[model samples]
Target: QVQSNGTALVAFEKATGKVRWAIGQELASYTSPLVVTMHGQKVLLYFARGGLLAVEPRQGKVLFHFPWRARIEESVNAANPVVVGSRVLLSECYGPGSVLLDIDQQWQPRVIWSDAGKDRWDRSLAAHWCTPIYVDGYLYACSGRETPEADLRCLDYNTGEVQWVQKRTGRCTLLFVDRHLLCLNEFGTLIVLKPNPQKYEEAARYEITDLEYPCWAPPVLSDGILYLRGRGRLVALELIPSRK
Candidate 1:
């Protein structure tokens, strides 16, 4: 279990709840750890306060460490690292907008490109906590630090070039499935849109008026039912029609 305030990461055995291994006296952001295979080796990445660390999952060995933190005092490393090929993309709204890193076979990280060097909105995708989903060489995401200024954006993932931006969707968390982007805004509104970098084509919208205000959790799709978390309740809605 990773501490909420970013101090220490503890791994536990599922059945017995025994502490398997605990590593680091490091600080972490609000984002969670991601396990992925890099350069043909399975490694765990923790975006900590000091930097990004690649650790051996089972034995708790630090393989490589990459320093990355927002320069602004109020800023944080909240977005989860998006792994592209042998590269990883990190972005935050407060500090540098976005940075692309190339990881070689030796597991060394080198910054290849950075969008934060430009303006905030000019970056690939400046997100608060909404992690952009990359598909078909493009990225679809909610870009901005606050709700009023947030925009639904599509960008070229490799070059950090903006394709299009739609301002109506306010600070959304999105999930991509079946070539469609399922976006859930902070207002608890669900919107379905086509995943296209050329333009924004919204298919439909469903608003949950009964739910309490500020639903920031990302919508979850399990089996055929869609789950939405509100103030204090869990809502389950069946998205697929029953076969009768």
Candidate 2:
């Protein structure tokens, strides 16, 4: 959680909300820490304002730390590393774009690749917001570029090659719900599509314009119903028809 003094506190959770341990730093963190288990070992990955820190979960013992100083500007990697197999894919904005690291090694992390063509690598931007969805030897990223138009990019997971570029004139977000690929645009438009291998195809399209300002939050899909909120109003709609 982000503290008031622009510092961060890494707290360990115990039984019944009892504090097991925590680490406070001089700078706050906006990036969310990701916890994962590999080979029966649970580890906590934290990307703070200053740099990246890894710690053990049993007693909060720090494993190792490394500073990312690409530029002297205020920088912190917000794109939580996407872990696949023994590799972790991490992306950053502002001075850093994206980097792939190998986590199976016994020593510190090793960098595999980083893209240099993109100007600003803000993954949360229109063209960069799509989660790096991994598929048959490919990873997909959708974000807005200089023209504020959403662009769907299919990149090679290993080589980072541009497979295809599709200019989508809208905002987009992706999530998997009930075996369906859920996508939403900025203007309260929802599109359910399957992550097709050949191209993008929508399974269902619906609009939820509430006569309010633009939606700033991502929509949530639950059960067979979709829920969205704007301007202190909650709109819930039944997606698939339920059994009579």
Candidate 3:
């Protein structure tokens, strides 16, 4: 486990209570520490107010630390960092926008690109629980800062450029199946849109009969199954129609 005293980052072994490593730097944060493995090396990812920082797990050596000028409310990131191939996707809602970083052979970090549009729209940064998705050659994300308004957007993974934007969607909880983007609204309604660059084309949609308010959650798609939750209840749905 990793613990921060605000001025220092510390990692410990739970079972043996051994102190694996310790690094110091005060960062405002309400975000969680994420454990990741890159290039076969274990690393801990942390959003320490100033910016995103990556450190070696076993040795507790910081791989790279990039500083940004943006400030996050409560020092929180609504989403987690999505690692793809050689780069990591870092996004914040409040004006700092998003950045794509390339990790070098020496573990140094390089800024591939930046997007100011990724910042908070209506003001709240951590609006949704859904993290950014890097699938195919694009990154899928949702923004719903103003009202219950949401925008389902796609961006190029290698370029950090927006592929397309689908507007007028409510607070969207997102999922993917067979390369399709599946989403949910504040209600129990569902939407299916193609993650395309040319245009927005919806392939399918459905609504939950009695599923009511605060369906403000994202659906999970797995192995041809779809799971939804609302009003403290969980329901499983079939993604594909029955063979019979």
Which candidate gets the maximum TM-score versus the true structure? 1
* Count of steric clashes across candidates, in order: 2, 10, 2
Which parts of model 2 have CA positions greater than 4 angstroms off? 1-9, 16-18, 24-26, 66-77, 116-130, 145-149, 211-213
Question: In terms of TM-score, which candidate is stronger, 1 or 3?
Answer: 1
Model 3 agreement with the true structure over 7-102: per-residue lDDT tens digits: 456777899987767785846554567887677777788766677778776777777887753553453455667788668777665446677788
Please state every model's RMSD to the true fold in angstroms: 2.6, 4.0, 4.0
Scored against the true structure, residue 18 in model 2 reaches a CA lDDT of 57
Output the worst ten-in-a-row residue range by lDDT, candidate 2. Answer: 121-130
Q: Flag the better candidate by lDDT, 2 or 3.
A: 3
Per-residue lDDT of candidate 2, residues 1-244 (tens digit): 4345523544646555655666646365456777887546777777666667677866777776655423655554544556676566655445555666666545377777764354664332222334556666666655552236566556666765566655663645566665556666666777776666567666888777762445435567788787776556778889788999
Q: Tell me the lDDT of model 2 at 125.
A: 26
Pick out the ten consecutive residues of candidate 1 with the lowest summed lDDT: 1-10
TM-score of 2: 0.76
Candidate 3 clashes between residue pairs 3 or more apart in a chain or in different chains: 93-119, 93-120
Of 1 and 3, which scores higher on lDDT?
1
Residue 173 lDDT in candidate 2: 57
Query: For residues 32-94, could you state the per-residue lDDT of candidate 1 as single tens digits?
Result: 888998777888888766568888889888778877666756667777888878888887787
Name the better of 2 and 3 by TM-score. Answer: 3
